[model samples]
Target: MYTPKDFVESRLPVLHDAIRANAFGTLVTAGEGGIEATHVPFVLARDEGPMGTLYAHVARGNDHVARHAGEVLSMFTGPHAYISPNGYPGKATHHREVPTWNYIAVHAYGTAETFTDPDRLLDLLSRLTEQSEHDTGQAQPWKLSDAPADYVAPMLRGIVGIRIPIARIEGKWKLGQNRPAADREGSARLLEQCPGDNEQAIAEAMRSV
Candidate 1:
């Protein structure tokens, strides 16, 4: 993650919050054939391990199921926005600032294992669904039980559950912490004026820092 000292975030709770907020992550592994990556949503068990445990599922036919062994990396990306030098308060005077990006990202490293237990897989699916539905602010969140057992059974059989107890974790919050306060504030203001959700989020994060 090539994080500078100013951007490094080592707090456990902070890292956990980032993972939970951005649960859909890229899982990377190296095998005899080559490196493989899979994008999946992960459920974090914060108290399960020293760092945390991640639960996810992949299709039974996914090559990741067979190739994922030993060390694995899961990357979670949070809000990000491009910062234009024009937003810097001192740009007019010094003309030294260049464009850059502000973002939050977390990397988790662990050993991955796969399971076929129907009950465990079902539980994983339910938790993922519940979290996603809650995020949508639905009046009634969907549950696994909403579907027929027979129909779900076949679906469950088509996938494999993955468990990874985090051994190492790193977080980087590049919210212009290294920049001058006036410049940071100026950039944040510009970010808020941008049209995307991510830009707004980055602006908020910059304010907090």
Candidate 2:
């Protein structure tokens, strides 16, 4: 991300929230054949540094995982909305005003190691399920231990767990900060009434800006 100083989100907590809220990320890597990418849900761990670790898994048959093991990029996408110049109060004064996109995103660069251990893979799956299901109400949640060993054993071979040690992380927030206050207010007002979730998100982001 070509993040300008004004738009940079350097706070580790904010960056971590971005990753957690948007757990799904695109993994990119290169190998002898060429570049490959895969979309996967990631589990982010925040320990030291403003940066954090990324844990995810792919199908055993996915060749992309092998190439991405040593190094990879995990991207997280936050709320994004379209901002029309019409929403700007200064549109009349600034005839050159144009529509723009308001959004936030984070890119994580890291080195990954794949785990072939069956027990580890099971543990990873448990953690992933718990994290993802936290918000959803499931009176009786599902668990690997609840499943029979015979069925679970075959399932384990189908996936591979990969751990990525964080090398770098970048976050960008573009919420019409460059626009005049009047324009910002106007755009935010229009967004609040918009029906889509994305538009509502923009409305909230503008308030923060």
RMSD of each: 0.9, 1.8
Off by over 4 Å in 2: 48-50, 68-70
The residue-by-residue lDDT of candidate 2 on 101-142, one tens digit each, is 999999989887888799988888888888877756788777
- Cα error of candidate 2 at position 194, Å: 1.1
> Any residue pairs clashing in model 1, and if so which?
none
Across residues 1-209, which tens digit of lDDT does each residue of candidate 1 receive? 89999999999999999999999999999888788899999999999989989999999999685765589999999999999998898889989889999999999999998899999999999999998888998888888899999999999999999999999999999999999899889999998888999999999999998
lDDT minimum window of 10 residues, candidate 2: 63-72
Q: Which is the leading candidate under TM-score? A: 1
By summed lDDT, which 10 consecutive residues of candidate 1 come out lowest? Answer: 61-70
Name the regions of candidate 1 deviating beyond 4 angstroms: none
